[model samples]
Target: MIEATNTDLNSPKTESQSGLASLDPRSKILLACGFILTLSLLPPGEFLIYGLLLIVLYISASLSDCSPVYLVRRSVIALPFAFAAVTLLFTIPGESLLTLPILGIDISVEGAIRFASIVTRSWISVQAAILLIILTKVADLMWGLQGLHTPAILVSVAGFTYRYLDVLRSEASRLRTARQARSATLSAGRGGGTLLWRARVTGWMVGSLMIRSMERSERIYNAMLARGYTGEVKTLTRFELRSRDYWSMLVAALTAVIIILVAHFL
Candidate 1:
């Protein structure tokens, strides 16, 4: 029954940290989602619209007092999917720009535009998500989702995943440290000479780690039950929407709609 601390207590101040952190979590979530969904519908290759959106996003990041470099780096996590989207370069029909010799693949100009659009949209969407996370506390976010009538199971899963992810990581680190300590390369001749034997040992280590994880989970669950833990999560954050929340929501909705319209026009 561990709870999660989403924000860094020791992290230095950012520009938007104060402003974005003060807004209602529900408002932020809705606005971010709205922006992402609307932006997704935007026509590809509309650089003007994407530029406007990027400006808005960069401003939001700045207000949140978050580092622009950090946000850009974090958003790049979605870029790997660009490789998958690039396959459209071949499967899609368009004027051929060039062809590879060995694979005989024809690259199309239309496909190139579409691929750029895909990558741009993904980068923007990921940045939006990262901004939301940077400004919202994990517990407050879960509470907001519950208020929004999100599926209870999904909320519960998110809560537990956030809570236990660090625990699992710590356990894995300890296991790795112990293994390395016990199997020093100084005696590599006897126990770690053969590659096959080394692989078997690695497999055994993984099995042992899984067993430990299961035992730890069972123990934690039993302990929670003994303490009268139910399946319900209670939080102290209150969802009181003031004039600011409504105003922000209105501005965000209008901005999204306008952007969507502009995208369509472009």
Candidate 2:
């Protein structure tokens, strides 16, 4: 969803393109995918390799001209999802480190390592994604996906989602505002009511929102059909891979493989 951010694909002459930005979006997308796959396939507890991949991620962020603050802020978005790995700390069987006081659950050393690996990979993947989005504009990225022969339906869905996301956000805001006008006068405690009441209200709100969204979507689809929208979405230009793309891919794939080999052997 980096498309939600402000990034210009078209710029006048004299704009500097260095490092990651110098590469075509399709090349970069494939390179990033390869790098992530390499990282994911590394043996568990290969901390040395993981550390090396982390360095590569930092280098990528720097090459994209990403501010450290912005990178950290964006990276936090994936942390909540990583918390699912925390369950592994208790689920995996191994030597126990500690037992829960009441339930008597054990935390195993192997499980801790596994959990850490999961979280580390998740963080690395998010950082790499953010770097790619920062360096490449959404339009180019979408075009790159099309060039890569990604499913046309998937591409169209992504395009439409990004296009109408802001409209959905606006609708949500209006819904919340309408609710707040009445909620402000109520004595409901945390988040507007008792837990059970809150659940009921939430369900009601969600149902209303769904109905409104469906109606709006139906109208939009009809309007588009009236305007003669075909099933295919077309872009102005078809991007071609260059010699630089081959070199970049070779370098990225080679570097990742070398790191994995070294991490495995040493």
Candidate 3:
């Protein structure tokens, strides 16, 4: 139900390309999928692979004109969950590397290593996904997902959500601005009742936004019906897989095999 803000949806679209524009959309999608799958399936206990993937992602982001600091900052929001999972590794019985008598806890070196590895791998994987979103438009990505066998219903929902998110976000922002202006005028000298008033205003704003969104949805459906839209959503085709896509797929397969083999024997 949450919609994307206009700035959130449009800022990435205006990003300066770093030569990736030459590659067809299919090739880019293949490369992105290949990298994500290969890295994710690799053993998370190994720091070397995770580190390598992080470096690869950083380089990729840099080449695509994505700010490394911004990507890392945004990616860290999910780090807490990763860290919580990592904490469990220390609790499970394993070879103890150190015992902290004051804390009454035994730390396993293997557990600590695995924890770091998983966090790093997760961060890198998220960065890859964020980069893909930044580089490709939502419509193009949805089409690519459809070609890759994502269910039609889910794809339709994703397309609709993307299209309406900006509209909803704009409405929310405008309401927020109006509330701030009213507060400034009504509470210029008073401070005690500001918080309560703001909370009430926010609740009302949310309710109004929902009602407006529902009305807009009805209008959109009616417009579609007037245009003779059937159950299917028609979209312009813009992608074709080239030799590069095959090459990327082969590299991904090889990487997966190699990682599995390494995890098994080494």
Candidate 4:
């Protein structure tokens, strides 16, 4: 029953305080991106390789102080959608669970296997993404994207969007509380409103939030200007890959290469 709006991006859980914080952001980014790319590009039928990758991710998440429960909970949210798409595979005509006469559709064993493979791959991929967010700060993610040659405008947009989302959310929460307080005496059944009235209220809320955000942006710009702001953001700490970083990268690369070779041979 936890509302999504109550999720705080800035609050670091106990898992965030693990060894991951000690590693350079660059290393975390490289490892995460490399693993994700390999998983996505590799054949989903390579169960061995997928299993190894999942283990690696679990270890990394553990070292980072991320709770396995939290990771699993967040990752499982996508399972329903994946399940829906794969469910159709069981209904296709072939050697499936059962043959149906109503719709000349045949379900095959291959389809069921493929469906299972897709589900496993989807689960692993989602977990990888969640781990990435857990290990790397949002600012570091933006910086990493920049380093990877992402467009400046796109990076700027992402940065601004992340910053403003919290502001807007806070405003919305405050408004909701105020509304609840004012309507405390109203019966729940009578609280329903006309579509037009609801639309008008939503529009007003959006307009007010927009104005507040703009004003806040102006103030931020002025503060930056006073501090001799430049177009480039400079980081206080320079990222240097240590021996462990190279070792980690080497291990991941070797695993990927082995998987590719096995897939080709088998």
Best by lDDT: 1
Residue 204 in model 3: lDDT: 94
User: Across residues 114-183, which tens digit of lDDT does each residue of candidate 1 receive?
Assistant: 9888898889889888888878877888998988999998998798778877777667667666766676
lDDT of each structure? Answer: 0.79, 0.76, 0.73, 0.72
- Pick the TM-score winner: 1
Q: In candidate 3, residue 262 scores what lDDT?
A: 84
Question: What TM-score against the true fold does each predicted structure earn?
Answer: 0.81, 0.80, 0.76, 0.79
lDDT of 4 by residue, 1-266 (tens): 12447455764544354666556666777776777777777764677778887887788778777766677878766767885766557654556565658986666776776677778878888887787777777787788777768898798778878977877787777876665556433455444467686677668777887888889889988987899877656655456667877777788789877777776677
Comparing 1 with 4 on TM-score, the higher-scoring candidate is 1
Where does candidate 3 stray beyond 4 Å?
1-7, 13-27, 59-70, 95-102, 181-203, 225-231
Residue 246, model 3, lDDT: 69
Clashes of each: 8, 0, 0, 10
List where candidate 2 sits over 4 angstroms from the true fold: 1-16, 91-106, 184-200, 218-228
Global fold similarity of model 4 (TM-score): 0.79
TM-score winner between candidates 1 and 2: 1
State the lDDT at 213 in candidate 3: 97
Which should have the higher TM-score, number 2 or number 4? 2
> TM-score of predicted model 3?
0.76
